[model samples]
Structures are given as C-alpha cells and as structure tokens.
Target: MLWVEKYRPKKLEDVVISKKLLDDILKWAREWDSHRKPLLLAGPPGTGKTSLALALASSLGWGTVELNASDQRSWPVISRIVGEGVFNETLSDEGEFLSSLEGKRKVIILDEVDNLHKKEDAGGEGALLKIIRKKPLQPMILIANDLFALSRDLRNHCKVVNFRRVDYRSIVKVLQRICKLEGIRAEKDALVLIAKNSAGDLRAAINDLQAAAEGKKKLTVEDVATTIRTQQTDIFKVIQKVFKSFDPEVYSMAMLLDETPDNIIWWVSENLPLEYEGDDLLKASLV
Candidate 1:
C-alpha cells in the first residue's frame, strides 16, 4: 500500500490540524441538525481537508457517502445517491433497518463543490441549494480550493473554514514518524529538505519521502533532492509582471508563465486587490 494511505489519520485526534479547529468541526458534526448549514472547507490541495473530513466521520462513527469530480456528478446522480442515503435514516446502504442507530446520520462529502460543471452537469449547484434549503437529515461537508468560485448563496449557507498550508515543521514531524515506523533511518536535514520543497503540501512531502526512501536503509538529502522537484520561476514574479510591468506587450510576460491559464486567472484575481487600490483597484477589476 502507498505510505500516504497507510499513514493516513484514522481519527480526528490523529490529524495534525489545529486543536481549536478540530473541536469546532467535531462540534458541528455532533450538532448537525441544529447547525443546518453544511461545512465549507476551502484549502489548497494536499493540505488534509479531505482526510480530516473522513476522520471526522470515523470519529463520529457515522458512515460516509462521498462524491468527487471522478464520479458522475450530474444533478440526477447526486439527487438519487444523496436522496437514498439521507431520506430514510433508519436503514443502512444494504437496506437493513438499524434500530440501535437512532439519530445517526451518514456523512455526505462533496469534493471540489466549487468546480461543479455548469454545462454538462447542469443543475448541480441548484440541486445542492435545494437539498440544503430543505435541511437534509445527513450532515454535508463541501470541499474546494477556491471559495469565491462557489455561488454567494451557497457560501452564505455554509459554515466556511479556511485551511492554510501546513507549516514545514509540522510536515517534517509527520515524515519523521513515518520514517520511524518504516524502520528507515531518515536524516533530519533530509526530511527538512523534503518538507521545505513541498511548499507546505503534506501529501507531496510524504510521497517524496516514500520515493526517496525506497530500496534504501537510510535516506539522505541528495536522495530526496533528486526525486523531489526542479527549481522553477517564482509565482510572485509572474504576478508582478502582470500588475507592475510597464511593457505594452505584457501578454508576452504572461506567456512565459508555467501556470495554466485556468490557474493564472485565479492568481491574478486573488492578488489584484492586494497590489492595487482606489482608482487602480477599480481599473484592474474592470479588466
């Protein structure tokens, strides 16, 4: 099995997230009926939001029915699956009534909810709103990298929680624990190198650690450096070129970017207000 899965946190207590945040999430899950609104967890990839949600379900001892981009996410599919799972609380997925499972609700986890397809998967967002407005029996957790991409109504209806990148130290500690468990003597400096290059992505760090430690009794910085990643132009440089460049042919600078246009738009939009203000901010927003 992949180390990422092997070492995944099985309970909320095992997750390396903030204690206060974990407590709040636990509280929300325990009081879902009164809370009403779904939990909107927005964060960058590999920051453990999905793992935390799954662990939360396990901690609450509630079964889960998850949907992601890989699944057929059309409105009909979502409605059918979610409806069957939540509409009747007395039965299990196997259609057996659990008399002892009173007040227990299945966890509905929708990954990348902000990226719902409006064209091919029409009515997805609308269906979600309808489901929430009706106050379904199950607790829902919506995951996304871009919070603003969600409709204002959807955002208004969720208890939004923003997850920042995990610090390198926290990442290194997790890596150290894995190395100790696998019986591979990984150098502290080597782990540090991997964690730093991971850019606060814990999943990436673990994958790097696994690849670097493969077929080796001891892991070194050189081993990790070779397997990790190559140096690239800083994202800040790309943003600066777009906002501060005097060059008339500014499109040329954008062409030099390694980021896909899909990501570039968000980067520019997210950073525009930070770099521009007053008339400048208004002008940038227009474009």
Candidate 2:
C-alpha cells in the first residue's frame, strides 16, 4: 500500500514523456474562454491520466472536483458540480480577514468516462453530449482508457489527446527514482527486466519492482528472475521448430507453439511471400 501511490507522479513534468501534450493542455488552460470545449484524455491504464488532471488543476490555481465513470455522471452531477451552481457559490473569509485567491474557473476531472456505457433508460450519454457541445462555466476534462469506445457525439465535441505507452528508458528513470526514495539498491539489469515485462506501463513496472523488492534492501537480476514474470516469446521458437521438422504431426506442432492464434496468423502472413511459393504458399495460407 505504501509503495502503490508513493511513486505516482504529481505533475506533468514528472510524467516522463508527455511534454508535447502537456504543453498543449497548458496552452488551452491559459487561453481559457467561456466556450472552451472539454478535453478528452485517452490512453491505457497506468499512464498518469489522473495524475495529469490533478497537476493541471494545481498549476492553474483552480479548485478541482473529481468523479469517476462509476459515479452518477448524468446531467445533474455535471450541473451541480461545474454548471450554474458552481458559479453561484461563494465562501466568507474567516475572522483573520485573509483574502481568498480562489479563481472562478474550476477544473472538473471525470475519470474512466468511457466506462459510462450508453444507457437507453437514463440518457447519461445524452447529457454528456449536450455538456460537451455547449460551453461550460468551468473547464472540464474527461479521462478514458479507450477513446474509440466513446459515443460519436461526445467524441466530436471534445478535444482529444492520446497518451501512449511509456518507453523503456522513461520507465527505467521512474523505477530508479522509486528505488532512491525507498532506499533500495536495484541493479540496472533488474530494473530493465521489470520495465520490459511491464510492456510500457510505468505503474505496472513500479508495482512489479516494489513487489520484487519486498523483504530485501537490495534487488538483483536473480530477484527479478524469481519474482517478476513476462509473457513468453516462445511462439516464434515453436513456429521455427514446426517449419524445420518433417514430422507428420506438423499441425499438432503448430498447435503446440507458444503463439496465440492471432500471433500465429500474423507470423504466417508476415513471411509467407518471402519463404513459400506455389502450393506451399497456398497451404500456408489455408493453415
């Protein structure tokens, strides 16, 4: 639990490799108008969607209200949180007479908005569509794992920005920072292994590193070998074995290969023209 959220980035600059998008988001914040359209952040998990939203709110010195996809995302919630009600709210200063610096513009972050499946009964998507189409009193941002899953109305109304998988080097730097914070000495090889296994997910890599580092002050390749696991790349090997073998059970061998059917099909498609000709090519195609 301690390491789970400890390593999370608190600002855009700390988010490893999202400089361009961060710049664009900040620019939009600076150029805020009454009609500023909602911004949609689309990406896979562990890529700092929540972190970026919070960081942006902080940067602008604005009050932030967050809601996840599972919450009541209907028009009522949106209106109460960011619509006319927010604009009408005011707070009195304490007896100290300290002046408040709170800005009128608030940042409302909606997480996993893609999970708000279209409901014919509730018209949840309809409400969101109208909100996005019309200008809001406060700036709103939507976070979703899959942008394609969003409704056409919501998709077109908002400015979409994609968050891609973290690269190997960036993941490494993040892991190193965690190691330093935790006072754990981890080998470069171990860090690289965790990063590679994470497949470009910094959160997953950090979790794996923390899990592997448990009960030890030092982390090594042996620790990673015993703790962290990765999807096998044995599919290619199995394919090669089937191609080289003359056994009548070649079909069975193909089946035994570590590849998923999708991968097997891709491998066959990739090298068919280069390696097979005539009837053999036709047979491969049929396979």
Candidate 3:
C-alpha cells in the first residue's frame, strides 16, 4: 500500500495540524442540526482537506456521499446524486444509513470544488447554491485549494474555514512514527530533510520517505536529499523563497531542480500575493 493511504488519519485527533480547526469541525458536526450551513474548507493541495472531511464523518458515525471532478459533476448529475442522498434515508454506497433518526448523518463532500466553474460543471454551482439556500437535510462540506475561485453567491451560503500548510515538525513526527512501524531504520536528519523538502505537505513527505526507503533497510540524509533533488521542486516552496530572498540563488536553485524558466515564472506569478505583502508584492511582480 502507498504510505499515504496506509497512514491516512482515521480520527480528528490523528490529524497532525490545526487543532482549533479540528475542534471547530467537531463542534459543527455536533451542532449540525441547528446550524444547517455547509462548510467550505479552503487550503492548498495535500493539506488533509479531504482527509479531514472523511475523518470527521467517520467520527460522527455519518455516511458520506462524495462527488469529485472525476464524476459527472454537471447540474443534473449532482442534483440526482445529492438529492437522493439528502432526501432518502437509505444506506449510502458505504452501506451506512443516511438518517438523523438512526443516529446517522449523511455528509455530502464536493472535492476539488474550485473546479466547479468548468464548462462541464454548467449550472452545477447554481444548483448547489439552491440546495444550500434551501438547507438540505444532510450536512455538506466543500473542499478546495482556492477559495476565491468559488462564486460569491456560492461562497455566501457556506461557512468558510481556512486550512494552513502542515508544519514541518508535525510532519517529521509522523514520518518517524511511520518509519518505526515499517521497521525502516531512518535517521532523524533524513526524516527532517524529507519533511522540509515537502513544503508542509504531509502526503508529499510520506511519499518521499517511501521512495527513499525503497530497496533499503536504512535511510540517511543523503538518501532523502537525493530523492528530493531528483524530483521537481515544490512550486509552493519555490514561490516562498523567491518572495523572501532577493538573492540570485533563488533562480539558480530552480534551475538546479531542472524547473523550466517558464514554469518557475508562472508559479511565482500565481503565488506572489500569498507570500508577499504591500510594496514587497509589487516589487516582486515588477521583477
């Protein structure tokens, strides 16, 4: 099994970051019947947004009806799937009942909600807006990387919750525990290096560790460094360094990672505001 799946968090407490956010989600679940507003969890990719949604549902003994870009997410499809799950008290795909009376709540999770604006998703957002405004019988959670990508009308119907990147220390701690469980003799420094290079993405960090530990009983810092250097530099980390440092080495580092100048420029332009402020943002843009 992939380390990411094998080590997936099963409970809210198992999530490594954002204690307050977890608490808030639990509270929301507890008070869901009274507060029928959907939750919009906005964060960067691989920051456990989907995991948190699933884990929260599991903890509450709720059934889940998940729809993503992979599924036909058009207006008709969403309406049919979501309507059945919301209105009917039948068991979900996972064989869990979908009624509050049975101590079960069906959570409708729309993953990659930012992609809802695509042509294929025509009228999908509008239908969702109507559902939220009408207040469906079941709770709902929308997960997306970019909050602003959602329509204003859709955004207004949900309670937005922001998820920050997972800290490196928390990621490293999880890596150590995984290594211990897998019986892979990994150096602390090696795990730390992997965590740092992952740019606060726990999923990426675990993948890197698994790749480095392949065909070896023990792992060293060199192993981790080699794995990272061989792969593409995380665009988020590159953006952060470019904004924080004016050194020419920033460009050199991107080049060393074999990142194309065009791709680097695009990443920098896309994420400039996230890492810079005021004149700094303008100055970085000007450059």
Candidate with maximal TM-score: 3
Clashes of each: 0, 0, 0
Candidate 3 lDDT over residue span 120-202, tens digit each: 23455665676678676678888988888889878888888898888999998999999999999999999999888777778
lDDT per residue, candidate 1, 97-208, as tens digits?
Answer: 3443564557778887877644323446766777777776667899998888888888998988888889999999999999999999989999999899777788878877
Against the true structure, candidate 1 reaches a TM-score of: 0.75
lDDT of 3 at 237: 63
Runs of candidate 1 with Cα error greater than 4 angstroms are 69-75, 84-86, 95-104, 118-123, 229-287
lDDT of each: 0.77, 0.70, 0.76
Please give the range of 10 consecutive residues that has the lowest summed lDDT in model 3.
117-126
- C-alpha lDDT (0 to 100) for residue 49 of candidate 3: 89
Error of 3 at 107 (Å): 1.3
- What's the best-to-worst order under lDDT? 1, 3, 2
Q: Which ten residues in a row have the lowest lDDT in candidate 2?
A: 90-99
> What's the TM-score of each model vs. the native?
0.75, 0.71, 0.76
C-alpha positional error of residue 131 in candidate 1 after TM-score superposition, expressed in Å: 1.0
What is candidate 2's CA lDDT for residue 80?
Answer: 48
lDDT of 2 by residue, 84-128 (tens): 423433222221111235424457788878877586334366656
- lDDT for model 3, please: 0.76
Relative to the unseen true structure, what is the Cα RMSD of model 3? 7.4
